[model samples]
Target chain A: MGGDFHWVATEPSGAGRDILPADAVLFGNGRQALYAVLMEGRRRFGWRVCHLPAYICQSVVQAARAADMECRYYRALPAADESPDWPPFQSRHEVLLSANVLGFSGLDLVPPDWPNENRIEDHTHDPWSRAACESRAGYCLVSLRKTLPTPDGGAAWSPLGLPCPSPEALIPGHAAAGQEKLAAMLLKRHYLSGMAVEKEEFRAWQIQSEAAMSIQPTSRPLPVTASMLPHLPWRRWRVERARNAEYLTDRLLGSLTAPALEPDRREVLPPPTPRRFPEQCPFAVVLLCRNRRERDRLREALIQRRVYPPIFWPLPEEAARRHPEAADFAARMLALPCDFRYTPEDLEEAAEVIREFFQTEAG
Target chain B: MGGDFHWVATEPSGAGRDILPADAVLFGNGRQALYAVLMEGRRRFGWRVCHLPAYICQSVVQAARAADMECRYYRALPAADESPDWPPFQSRHEVLLSANVLGFSGLDLVPPDWPNENRIEDHTHDPWSRAACESRAGYCLVSLRKTLPTPDGGAAWSPLGLPCPSPEALIPGHAAAGQEKLAAMLLKRHYLSGMAVEKEEFRAWQIQSEAAMSIQPTSRPLPVTASMLPHLPWRRWRVERARNAEYLTDRLLGSLTAPALEPDRREVLPPPTPRRFPEQCPFAVVLLCRNRRERDRLREALIQRRVYPPIFWPLPEEAARRHPEAADFAARMLALPCDFRYTPEDLEEAAEVIREFFQTEAG
Candidate 1:
């Protein structure tokens, strides 16, 4: 399992040399990387952080609160066609967290003129490539567990600079424990479907143990271990994901409106494109329902059928009252599954179920 | 799976012979039942909830806070010739939650002068027969998932005059979904072993789904399903638990003391006595450490070895400061496992490990 696979940005073609210079990379699991930046931003830079809306879980909000930072939500503007009335930056020393929404939309909507002291791009949705190219203060964080086979791995890279803590600083036996836990989690996820939901608790336990294992007074730059970068069948994963998404989209199109994706923009990647976006990465198909009530009804119906669609992140009542447009959009949105796990046939079946539900109602 | 075992009680079969009549049964899983009765107590009956000091977990305190109740801690007054406190009911409650403290001490500790309104027993711990009798509360709650194979089953029974909702009043398909979720949880717990730690997400998902499924119109009582009650191997479970407790107690006698019990006070039962004096149900062996630091250190060490020993419940910092003696007692207490899952050999092995730990420290 140690030397099984290696993560290649692009498959080596004896044609060109690797161009990216290595900076201080802070390796972590998905949420860990997110928190690392949040903690760093507040402690080191004293920047106030504002998060994007409808992107992730309330745990992220709780994490922000844990860091004693105020969280302000901004709606994800509709693909290149519509630009949001972006709120004024309250402070120049503010930090913006541009989360990769459903792993598809972030690259296209990187706010061009946003002024901030630092920017943390979260690639938990898709860690294959960096979403944001340049920023006043750019630090991209990637959670490997979401997209890759590795049980636990996360990396924070900064083109500007990185404050890499040394390996000596790491808790003793942490890497081994982490690897073991990751293996256990992956095994349970694949072999025992019943145990998949328990992954969060396992991760929490790992976090606690890892925290305990951290050694004080450290000064060795911890190199990302080869064990962390296992070979991921990105091409195969991407192809299946795209097919599933397309199938679901076509099936749901009659009754549910899938979120619009701009066709003009090509995905940001290196030349030769070992990974084809059209064939590989179709993250999620966000559907717009008739109303909040309808969306909730659809959710409940799907849940009864053992299909758990993503939940709507309820906005704080005050925020909703202040931003009616955001509130309305949040209510109507429902993110459907379109990952490597589901097949095209599964998507078609799901779509059929959705169609029949609405068709029966219409009749 | 449904008809594989038999049900037994401590007392002679009476009028409600076919179906056991539970007085104010607490429903939901172990944690939820504890929360429902203890946490939710303040809202229904203010200032009557008195919690024991020797319990495990901080969530209980959180539950109490959520229910707008204050927790009053009591010292576990040790019996004559015992160094450590036994059957810790040092304080009185108008509404006492009879937690089957590791299946033993709870029954005997129901004070002779206990007020009738003061007995809300939590059968989550032992859940055998007599523990139910210890509570004279109008209502009692049982976490069905803990003892039975059912995925989700909870009962609220009242001994005093109160209207019990008829079977016709239960929500449609509520029991089925709850059972399925509970089955999934139990299966994961049994088969996955360590993976059970990670199942929080799945449990949360199940909780959300169950909550949705159980919503009934306030117009009528939801119907209770007959299939919810299955024959559990109470006798076998009790015997195994008692064996394990005895094994550990013998090993820890010199170093740590078991909770005391009066031998002559044991009650008769239908088959397996549900209510046991300290001698009868002695599986859960709780010991008082030197201090909170020692207790926490031991807990951490045990966790590192992939062995979890229950520590005393966390006292609120404010409360601890206010009641130093109670805090001191809490800091020193640790509960050893004595579940039916452990055989005599397993209990011996666990005891040996614990003995070795203390012995090595002493040397």
Candidate 2:
């Protein structure tokens, strides 16, 4: 076996002494984890209706669908106080999904009157949030791939310490997935190094490998992935990500109106403010464009400089019909990478590129 | 990029020109396929109650549980005519799992009056049975790995041309599972080729790899696995298996009890005749001991000689309660491999080994 052949994945554990007990299971992806709790809840409590935010990953909907539950949604927007603004809904027996987008928000958004046992936090983008992991909701869920180098890992655990099936039972499925990802990781390393190779073909192959994992909805995380969980420099990475997000926000403050930087409280008209996700070890530095055209233009400019910023989603037709705000967010939002891999200088260069794009537009 | 590195999986296609229409989707295992159809049926038709044979793989129950449906099983006994004797209960909206075990039985057992639209055939063990592929059930599902060397693959298709999602979408999950399998395959090859490896250590690692695949359910067959689909010598395997079964049955007629060679219409107390399963590619050659004690003794004897014939299962408590016959089968039934890989002489050696043990016991 070569040194760079198979990658070490994130170990399945809590920050300190809290090993995600046997009751808290880790799976191949976030959706699978979400599916697990929904299925468990449905089987024991006859919960057939699943309630989640309109502004969430498509996988969340897919998870509910897989669990054979009726999906209903309510608003999940950042309020003026920068807390999650969960809209009121009449859900008696529905399983509610309380999600934290970009890691910082939504944990505080549960409607106080709803049964706490019904809420499952979709902390897919907020794996390291102390509040997310420590929450007293019936279940706390997180996806590791978004914040870590693991090929695939999603976790769901009982906050109440209920007895749950051990994820070890799902390992056969993880091993299957691990085979393809290991090859891709090796191929990626080879490509990233000075070795000459066909880049696009390799990339397409890697994408194909990744696509295969999504279809395996109920598998467990690989042992190699589970091994590195405790070793991750969580606090440092979290701090660096927060620092990077703050830095980018301060630089892009007046130049590009970021709603996340500080919510506008009122308008849906002019360019939306950059919504700042404070205190969270974010998946990316998110920015909102005035319109799709402006977003596309900035995206193109960034691409030319070899800086790739991904859009939140393309928006499914059903989702678009259900939440127009989500559709708008999909059209105009851009996510800049700020994971543990980047340095302050690298982020500075990326921010400068964004500044140049607007300055050129004004000229 | 070693030549013997990764085994190319079968290129997915329906048998012959049918290529399993676009409506047919493949997955990582048979349970995943079962889970898929169950979830789809529950979501689309308000099908919440699931009915399946008590005599089945543990994964079938696991899959049903994962789908969050109410599972109610019925007793299934091999009919006097060698077909499945399915007990009748009034079911209007319930989804029925019509399954084929040992690739020879059950398909013929479907009640003529039962709604075909409500039936989903678990043909994981019966891929080569022509009648099974031609069944009129709403969905026909199979796991390719049981019949093929591909590390992980499961397929579910609508024989009725129901609209289904493209399996290509699940490739990422498959790729993730593939990497672990490829590594294990490499290790297996190395171990087999006189590499002087630690046998148990390698086996544990391989087991870990397989465990990962079970976790990553709902994934597509790998492209490599799909590529080899057409090339698999299905006919040859079926013929070799049939011939081997007949030969063993002819030789061991009064000396042993084989449920799948040529069924004895009358006595279970007498020396058992071979029950025929001609024209089907079987997972193994079935043998039943007179009692659990004899089974244990024979199993140990076979192990001492390195001719390992595996017990069907060590029955689960719930399964044992629901289907005592299945539990009995599990305790006494043993399956001997008769795959394409075995040569005539190799099979003869295995058959002779069993013959010698029984002859000594009788003496």
Candidate 3:
């Protein structure tokens, strides 16, 4: 809870609504929402194969596998500013999946030429982004647990008002997982507020709750999460996160090329913009390093300054083998926290840590 | 939370300390404890087969199967008052499991002739009974979660002070399950105290937490349970339960043979004594009916009068087929809960309901 921004239980203030669709079907976690959507798609539209981003979380691949659907990978590297490079469409019984990576871009990952009815868009990073709000994809999915201060919640909805599947009645394991996660959040809140609760206590809850949720992929969301949805201040959180990400991006721009671990052997690559659109509530202000060694060094330096940045993912072995560029992008990238939990001062300190690391390495 | 007794979280008052052994190994639930003991036995003594009671919970069989040990059935019928009849023991590589069923008898279920080194005894119903306290078996296991107000806890120890395997570590799933169950108990406490909490909320937590615990068959107990074990009022609870059970048994003694469902075809079978030893804290005051039909009729009548009696078990298909008498015993038995939750007036009301049912059936 202290090392990274773990969610905490919050009072339901009823400050916002419409963060998700009124009819959004909720599940235990993001992967379950995705799995449910895939299975429903297979049932209603005869979707057989799903094309997924090469740069993705392993759980997504697992969800697809659990749905008994064949998966094909497409290029969706972090450096790509626009839509993923489209693979040839098999007009029958095939679906394409796209994600707004780290909310760095608008929800326009689905290529224009692709059939709109066969596309599934994941708006987990920034569900409030304008593009996501006006998404024309067949279905949209969001991982509410990641963004909201709730124990367990993943939502799926058809933006076009197509028939969607509702989750079966809540299962006991999933319910327990939600409760466990909720307890962790509550305990973390106590620890954060200078209470006697230990950090290990909350961490244990977070880890165990995830293990429980992983095995229960298609169960209904917890009752607490469902009740808390309308009360969450989603809009305010999004705005604050956007401001933090923008500030960090501007602060880090000048020293982007300063840390060249192998100056003589390689040409300096221009760092990509932190966000493709100004309107996005970016998940984080991402940095591109010269290599994995440099990224790891910067990560340690940030940690020393009490700035905990997360690696987007370690590419799954199959994806890494199939798409080396995606793997390389994953290796070179690190994400600085720009969530609502941070303030301007926190970002300033984090920015200073990044600059100091590069300056020290350059020396 | 309201219909049947579920655990309720209580403040640790340090009123009891010797309920469990000082070095007892803790687990997520009773079945997990059993599984851990079987696996440990296999590792230490090369034990490959386990003889389990025919009238037993399915989870116990599943646990033995999970440990890759062959299971053989024995006649440990509910009607048997003293020790189970001896089955040929393969002293070289076989283990025998016995239980103090509903705490009706002492920890003397293991035949006098059987080797103490090859016996495992379950004291789930009455861990504090005199016989359990003085057990001489190689191993003893108890389902602490069922008897205690803690979320999740099972314990394993050797009465002979022999080698025991400890849980590896607290896994995330087991930890979460404990938290969920704890939440349920807390909610139930509020409900019992006439709080506005919905009964379903706590009930859902109870159901889900159990599912979470079921899959984790060999994990450490929750930190809360570990800390609370030393403080639980175990002795007081046992004594209170014993008093309630004794009172109910006396009240029902006169009407025992009145419910002759088919008066002409069979001689009335005398009801077995609720407890073989008067000093025992019975898990429940069990009533043996004439047949399954009478048992079902009596169960419904009791429920209508707000007295919920649980069936010990419905025999697993294999067991039912292998031992028809055990199946018959299971079908004809209804356990009237005499746990510490009920007051004297509550027991009086339940006793009235039970007597009323039999009188109407006799008419």
RMSD of each: 14.8, 16.9, 9.2
**Alpha-carbon local distance difference test for all models:** 0.48, 0.62, 0.74
Error of 3 at B196 (Å): 17
Candidate 2 total steric clashes? 89
Candidates 1 and 2 compared by TM-score, better number: 2
lDDT of 3 by residue, A72-191 (tens): 998886453435777888765899989888875554575877788898898898887777878888899988876777778888898877787777877766877777776676556545
Per-residue accuracy of model 3 over B87-185 as CA lDDT, tens digit each:
887575899989877776554575776788888999887887777777888999988866777677888899988788778877766876777776676
- How well is each residue in A117-193 modelled by candidate 1, as lDDT tens digits? 46666655655433433433466765554455443455666756755322323332444344334323322332232
For the record, the alpha-carbon RMSD of candidate 1 to the native fold, in angstroms, is 14.8
Q: DockQ of candidate 1?
A: 0.01
Residue A290 alpha-carbon offset, candidate 1, angstroms: 15
Residues B1-363 of candidate 1 have per-residue lDDT tens digits of 111111121212222222335433323333344445553444444545565443433544454455555555544422212122323433443455445444544445454555545555555555555656545664565555445444444565656543333222323344334433532343244223322123443344345535543322211111111232423445566667666666666666634322232212211111133334433454356655655676677666666665667544556787678656656656776667666666667666666666665665455
Candidate with maximal DockQ: 3
Maximum-TM-score candidate: 3
Computed on C-alpha atoms, the DockQ of candidate 2 is 0.08
For residue B91, give model 2's deviation from the true position in Å: 74
Listed models, DockQ each: 0.01, 0.08, 0.10
Q: Give the DockQ-based CAPRI class for model 1.
A: incorrect
Residue range A1-363, candidate 2, lDDT tens digits: 011122333332345234343456778777778877887888777788888888787878887888898888876643224444454545556778888776646346456766778777777776656666567777888777776666677888877764443344445545555555655554454344423334453456556546666523477775445545555666666677776666665666555544233233212211224443343455566777767998899888887887778776776898889888778877877787766666778777778887777677666
- Rank by DockQ, highest first: 3, 2, 1
